[model samples]
Target: MTGNPTSRDYNKASVLDVLLSRAPLTRIELIELTGFSKSTVSRAVEELRADGCVVNGGVDEVTGRGRRSTYLDVPGTMGHVVGISFGMRTTCVLVADLRGRELRHVIVPTVDHQEVRNAAEWLVGLMAEASKSAEGPLRQVVVAVPGRVLGGTEIFGPAESMKVFAGPGLQRALADLVNAPVLLDSDANASLLEILTDDATLEDAALFSMSSSLSFASCIDRELLRRRTPAFGDIGVLFSGVGNEVLDGLLSTSGLLRFARGRGLDLERIDDLWLHPHEEVSRADVLDAFTTAMVTAVSAVAVTLDPGSVFFVGRLRPLVDEVLPEVRRRLDKSLATAPEVKAPTQVLGLSVARGAVYACLGMARDRLRDAVLEARRQGQHTEQSAPAF
Candidate 1:
């Protein structure tokens, strides 16, 4: 009403940001955190309900109030979220609930810098198959790419090469195929969000993804400090190398197979994983050199950011199940006391896709919080302006 954009939108948005970040809170709690009066909180809640943004949950038993203080939940039917992650030889797809829960996941084969058209078409087909099984309302789609993205935020997708996929290239392609509002992000950033949700140490931490093609980094928190900053060491080039010595050029299935052939091991003839797994890796003294690379990355992140924790994502987790031990062992050998090394392990085996779902959930119900605050403000004004004796 004041014609100033910051008027109530600011208050409403702050209120929503808090609510969505945590479970439901009573008006008293919201008032204390938001600095708004109980009257304002109540008005916002009522307005949210009217707008169909917040759901009227059942009673609150802990407070022992005479009447139930209506709890709030984001309207689940607002839309659908999808997550995609890619590597040199594999790709992952995930669907999530409005709350960001992974409803399902699918993994497929891929190639390096695979053709854009092939990737887009495959995504369309997968979503179609998923919709056949979906039972609830769906809208709003988000995508995660495994490179640095060119945008206001640099969560994952490689920031340098992402210019190729940025703007209309990917969003327009996906939108034309899926017919929904699409947002792109660095897949590693999405993975970081998934890990932060479960890793307590990650209350303030960073995740370094050591995968084929390129490595990515993400700093995590309940709230972003700088979102993406330079201090968070960038390691993409090291992963996707230029010549034969490149990590991606060595560890990728093709790379590994090439290395095996040079060592007289017929990788094409033998299913190395199922048959001679030992011979497949004994090509050189680099027994789990990738593990060392990952450990080195973690140690670097530790000394650099002193993040509460760090996680190793991508193919490294599965290949070297002993990654935590290996990382700690290396860190211990390097430092006098390794900053109280704790578990950097996580089960985001398919987290990027889950992050996509979370991105959507955060987007959909994310606004419910504002609607609640708006209602509370209106209620306060109504009561305050009433005639008094």
Candidate 2:
């Protein structure tokens, strides 16, 4: 309480961190997990409880020697966070509490207008509607976009449908509307964040997204590599080695649809390529082309980064299974060693939103911690400044 406000009270912060990460723990468990002395743990817990940051989660069922140890947890009343996955056609929005529990989730068709203001209004409306179900105030918002994010504020080199989110206008508009800090990141990065959350053991891995956009994100040594300006992970620009076409124009859902249509398959939806019956020869040709392009792209990533695993996500995930065996066979034949290639267990849209929620939850926790520290500092100052009675 007497320490500098700018500096972290390690004991207090450690106690809160553990509770947030692995909660429902008894005081003894907290001391054991944080390696803090009994008195320090008790003091920290008391302060957190006083600040309404931590709450008693009732007593543990298992009885100890003297009394049943009480479980401690971070209260859901801390605040809520919103995660938005802004896609070309459909946008997914998720609201989660401080404990990262989903409160509400909705998928709505994206606005057709190219106006950034209109798009922002649409998104804000969706967020406000979803936030109604939240148990607390909104603390943070993270938006996942299918484009290059520059400086966490602007979208660059976005697809034509996503042009409405380009520049700083959308980010600024959302911040003003939501009254909370907004984080803009590529959908690929958002997917990677979700993957990391699900599997903490992943050190060197790559996620390839073949949805509306063709991009990938990588984790090296358990750290995600991001850039202030757009670079890397733009696999869409890589040549497909099939004439003058890039993977972006060859492997993306849109690109695949275009190719199928051009081949006289009359494919309207991506699902139609596989689900709808087309000329067997034409369908085979299209699938073969897709398989080749995907193999080339995945090989490029595997060979360059040597990632331990490569996960296929996005709209094309369904088709990936059909081509994966062939893709793997080709990769094994082409490279001395090939990383494990498989589809992620979660759906692409949900994965992106969930990942963004994870980021939002982290930011919200930091804000809460800082607020608690500041409040304590102010209380201490008030006590010191009070005239002696």
Candidate 3:
């Protein structure tokens, strides 16, 4: 109701921030940590509890008076968030709680040219299914796109199906379906967030997603560095110095499959290329070609960002072990200093989805905190206007 925040506003925000960051605290602990009076902490916690932002945890051990004190926490069940990652050939849907704990994760096949509306419809169903078992109502949604997102809505990329979900209209469509605000993030950026959230040791890193297409996301000092355009690290757009062809046209799985087809190989996809043996084009040869193409891309990134580590995700995970040594070798030759290059050992397929979940969880927490403050403010105003009888 006020144009500017008051001391009370700052207090509420502080309490919520502390509890959300380091939770499962008893009233006494919250008072000590927040430096607010016990009554202020109690009132703040009560407001948050009423707003479903905080919940009562199990009772703490008996105190000096032989009375057990109940601990309070920002329960994961208080709210739910969804993260969706769209690939050229597949889409991953993830549902998680306020605490960023994964509840459901599912991967579905997608057509490269599905209508934008059709893609959104498919995502709605997938999101519902993923959140079916979650404890609370969904609070926020984040969609990680594989292309350039201009002005926050217009997405330009080769993924034809995503055109529908490109701009503000996409957010409205998704928000209406899930009854929650939707966020859009680059898939590579989401992957970068996932790596940072999982590994605290990484202050700066580069994440390269190699699928039918290639994208790069970088982070510095635990923050996503902004690019000139929405899609900054799309390696696919770069010319590979080989004729007039782009890197995506030269090195992506789709490109390799085309090469296989041209060579009279029976491989229909990259996965098929490995499963079935071709007399003329061996898997070794295909891998060797991929390594060569990736060497150039990796070198470019290492020399530019000079990140602390380089991670390969997506379809490239299966080949990371073999690819790591080769890329490292190439980088060692090209750059004065090469970062640590390796493949993620876990969350291989769901990194982008996990990042989305984390992003949505953060949004949900902020929203819930604001709601708690508003409720408290309204309650105080009501008390102040009450007539003295």
Candidate 4:
């Protein structure tokens, strides 16, 4: 038969999470904040300290106290984690502490974008320079790519995309270079997590990334939706036209430019749609088509996830003010219930990289808690197996 449920596990995790987020708390403060019994707080803190997960920060200064109290904190010397994002034109690397505070961040042009395999050495060199301030070996390294990552090894997308990770050698090289565990995630998925950090209201939402390829990440009840198919976010290639055309060819930045040219607007790039306001009348038709296609994809997401909110991320972010009204207008005419549409307010370059760092921080915290519990259990087993007195 199995032993009793690990019910106290919840309490331990709660206490540890608070400590990791805001440490150097006195016993009285922990007892008050955690709502745990005074004795329970003492015991938990003792066990955590014994496991080297928490350390005593000396006695707190008290002018009128009957007795000085000890403060406990998660030491900054615990370890560090790194998050990297590989985009179409640029690659961003971030080094952060276990608590997710940024120690360093660096952005560099992506070398040989079509052939990342040839630039593996350059990528490693960039990461090394970015992580120079790391106190010690990284606890985790999370890499976010513009394409889908399968089985933590293979990557799939357009031929000229982030296909370097499609092979296992690059992943292995990154792990070896950093001397840490590595995680691979889609850029859309990472961006989703980053958006949630700004507001607790976004428990469930969908992230629409309008980049080189159209992709999205859906979250339900604060948990990301995981799929087994690489085609889940391949909205770019989704069949649209009668014959050979696809969604990306109809609404992407490049696609909008092509549509404008067909209308004799003479626009060379998507940014021209906004940079030249005087030509707005000429490009109106192209904007209308762009908005229509974007709304159709968003409508599909709303029907599929019915999330509490839908966020616009990536390249299309700059076009939020220009297109939000149209997106809302279309959603109102189509859906029975349209979710709130939002654009990122924070200007953290490369949200995917920041999200990866956020995810790694969570993983590091959980692992540290598990290590403490395991150590405590072993200590108990040692006591039980000792010779009789």
Which candidate leads in TM-score?
A: 2
Candidate 2, TM-score vs. the true structure? 0.92
Candidate 3 Cα errors over 4 Å, as ranges:
1-3, 27-40, 60-69, 75-77, 111-113, 135-137, 160-169, 228-231, 241-245, 262-265, 276-285, 346-349, 372-389
- Candidate 1 residues 187-265, lDDT tens each? 5667777766665654666655545334454464554333344323345334422234445434333444454566566
lDDT of 3 by residue, 12-113 (tens): 678887887677888888999999998888776765665556788799876468778888888765768889887766788998777666788988786554
Q: Write the per-residue lDDT of candidate 4 for residues 1-389, one digit (tens) a residue.
A: 22322535446656777788667788888988899998777766765565455788789777974899888887666778888887776788888877677888898776764454456567677778987887755788788776666655556773245545575666776666656787777777888888776567778788876666656688988888877877777777765432344667655555555667777886666677677763666666666666666676677778777887888776656666688897898788888899888877644345688988988888887776665445334443311232010
Q: Candidate 1, residue 279: CA error in Å?
A: 4.4
Report every candidate's CA lDDT. 0.54, 0.79, 0.71, 0.70
Q: Which stretches of candidate 1 lie over 4 Å from their true place?
A: 5-11, 23-35, 60-69, 86-92, 101-115, 131-140, 152-168, 220-236, 239-244, 249-284, 299-308, 323-327, 336-349, 361-389
| Model 1 per-residue lDDT at 172 | 64
Q: Which ten residues in a row have the lowest lDDT in candidate 3?
A: 380-389
Whichever of 3 and 4 has more lDDT, that candidate is: 3
Q: Residue 79 lDDT in model 3? A: 66
- How would you order the candidates by lDDT, starting with the best? 2, 3, 4, 1
TM-score of 1: 0.69
Residue 329 in candidate 3, Cα distance off native in Å: 1.9
